[model samples]
Target: MSTDLSLFGVVNAGSSSLKFAIYEAESCLLSGQVEGIGVRPGSKARDAAGQPIPAPDVTRQPPATPAEALLMLLPWLRDRLGGRTVSALGHRVVHGGPQHARPERVTPALLEQLTVFESLAPLHQPHNLAPIRAVLERMPQLPQVACFDTAFHRSMPEVAQAFALPYAMTERGLRRYGFHGLSYEYIAGRLPELAPDIAAGRVIVAHLGNGASLCALQGGRSVATTMGFSALEGLPMGTRCGELDPAVVLFLLERGMSPAEIQDLLYRRSGMLGLSGLSSDFRDLLASPEPRARFALEVFVYRVARSVGSLAAALGGLDGLVFTAGVGENAAPVRAAVCEACRWLGVELDSEANAVHGPRISRPGSRAAAYVLPTDENLMIARHTRALVAT
Candidate 1:
């Protein structure tokens, strides 16, 4: 019989932090985060019931790099297991490029292939692999699996994936690859239960966090998405300048900006931060009384509403809309504004329901139903890991 693995580890490595959770047969036994990596790093954890557990060692004790952080977290995890064995480690790889359409067992070859997509997702790809390598060295016998953020959208039709570039350029692998697939996958899986009435129709899942994107789902499959080619190409994020005209890069280059400078500018200096010239945190902007903060929020809402229109077109119609992730789930004002902008699309937001961040916030007569749903990408990763390792 296949090994009925009981423990699974899920790691989501971002540019600045790693969020990890330990699961025993699908129940989260422990969850925590190591934040400020490469800066003033720190770690904190909690039990499945949400009780505060001690940090790996103490607050700010985690390493300042992905490799070091993974090494540190491994020992802590082993200690917490109390003799329980971790059957495998599952990773949330932000990019799978064109080849990886599903979870793949981590190998030297797989890691190498994933590295090739690093430049395509400069912010996430490298960090995602660091832990995989660290685990390989720390416990070579342990299995590792990688679940891709781009995998779920691999089912997108050719027309949705194509970039309208020359066939030669397209063959060279420059094309749209929708991101946040794992989050969308989780939301899609739950939509039937959360909003059964509209789950079968065309739905748009807006994952609005520090990183934001909209996935157009028809009958539970991706028909189109706002993010294409890279995470930097969709809605304005915490620092990313989304959906820039190609000529904008040319303009910057002609102005004597180097490629590296352009990369930093678009990926770090733009978005709400650039617009406000103040802060990137939506909470900060909302708390501020400054007009610039209001402008930044306006720009964000405007673009989100605009993307919804485009994605709706891709699906040929709209039935329901979902808001998820950080800003989508917590920022009631932002949701209200986006719903306000989309009023023309027949979205009638229930002011009271939106305020509480409930699962459903739409009016009965609304042509488009609006919902606030939480995403669980780690759960998705753990599920994939257990299935893969069982084989």
Candidate 2:
């Protein structure tokens, strides 16, 4: 007989931070902590609600490595969980390449397979793999699962996933594979509970965080998404340049810059931080008087609005718009700008309602409903982990 596991742990390890959550069966039992493992200089911790949190006592230096961060967080999690034993662990892996479409139990072979896709998601994959390796060393017997961010977008049409590359290159895995799948999955799961009418129709979810992307959902499945091939293809983010001309990359290479240097410039030195030269945080940019900050904000909004229109077209019509993640849940101005840009698509933003943070932020008579639904990707991971283990 299979043992019934009751608790599961989910971890999302980013380039600089680790976000964790614990679930009892399929329900989230507690919101987890964010441990700044390898944060850049001048970064600060914020509560899950986006309020500032006191930083843990650590030497003031460059960000701690992912392993060091996980070492610190494990103890904290143990204390908060009161010695609770999670039967399984789920990880949010950023790239699954062409093969993975669902959660899989982590093994040496699987890890080796995943390593091949590391170049496809250089900024996140290594960091994501670090904690899993650490946990494996610590708990040799514990079952671990990997849930890919690209998995949910697997249902995207062939035309949407492909580029006009040669068959040989395409076969080698050059194609769109959207990120933020767990977040989109969680939102899709909650739709029946939140808005049955819209959930049954066409839906677009905007996952706006340090890394942002939009997904088009029809009948509760992904039809298309903004991020293509790499996370760097969609919306401009905290540090990454979203989309650029192929010729730009060639030009940079021709300037004697190595591929690694070009990658760093595109992934770490661009986006809001590069454009603003002040801050990557939307709140910080909003507070700044610099014209560059204003320009960055405009660029972000413009890309988001443009993507919304494109995704809507992919869905044929827009039924609902879901705003999620960090900025999507809290940044009123960003949402306002996006809604204004989408006004032609029947979005009517309720200013006062939006300011107050409504799950339903659209006017009653608006043709397309707008909402602010907080996403819990970790919870989704935990659920998938539990299900896979139970079977």
Candidate 3:
């Protein structure tokens, strides 16, 4: 097919940033992001080897919206391309409702329908669509695909997805819909080669980043996950308050807390930032000697351990655990603390291996294995796009 080309571009838009990657088939050619979108001084680019590529022009022109930021990023990317054609664009959308449980081509009708899902994922869905819309307007002829964050979890059994709510509400689509699907999917695909022994059994992948979640896989298929209904329902994130009691919302409402104010408090003011009042960055928290930082870390570890236990029950037993994402892959102390808490479940951490970022952190005698697997959601998205668009 003359239309087919090897190049594919992936865009992952979040509330505060836009990350884009260009891939020559499965290999990443280059990637970049404009963090602090509404804020300033956040444009950064890098080549395949992670070497910084300066973008002075992007720094000079500030983008007021995520859509504008991606549009601004186009020319610089094009210049870098020299003359290569991008076969298709792949986007990471957080919520897909039940109607879209797989990667779907982006259409005007689909985009309109996705808007109704925005209220379900207030902070992420809109931003996820911004770059897609920008690309649509700039390159109307370009083929694009949306790889949903909730799609992979659709494989979960009814028992795993069901809530205690009435049948009517549950049938109306108010049920657990796990996120970080792309990340978990990538891990599932790679787990067999990475850990052949544990790949065929019960395992958990902790995607701990600014936005975090735990996913349980039984033989490389999603059986359960920590996130439910929305991205805010799982583990404590960089700024989002996770797993809050339902009564708390009523109490706040009764006390005259405006919905907007409450949203701001949970989605922007909470997490390690709220607990420490110092910093949300795990590196900053670890470097600081402040008791507040220590307490915040303790809370995060406690929640992760608890979630691991819950997921283990879902699996009926545990064979291994794999940590991925920003914090999971890098923060040694965080991983150590969580693993120590899970000692009863058979995790013996090799402190030396962990400190140096070893893939296998568990001692051979440990019952449940532990490993650090770096996740590549962009690569996952590109794979899905290529499969769907057939380039």
Best lDDT among the predictions, by candidate number: 1
Q: Over the full model, what C-alpha lDDT does candidate 3 score relative to the true structure?
A: 0.89
- Candidate 1's C-alpha runs over 4 A off are 1-4, 58-62
For each candidate in turn, the TM-score is 0.97, 0.90, 0.96
Task: Tell me the lDDT of model 3 at 197.
Answer: 78
lDDT of 1 by residue, 77-151 (tens): 877877566789999999998999999999988998899988878889998998898888777888999999999
Model 1 lowest lDDT segment of ten: 57-66
lDDT of 3 by residue, 302-364 (tens): 999999999999999989999999999999999999999999899999999999877999988
RMSD of each: 2.0, 3.6, 1.8
State each candidate's clash count: 1, 1, 0
Instruction: Show pairs that collide, candidate 2.
Output: 176-229
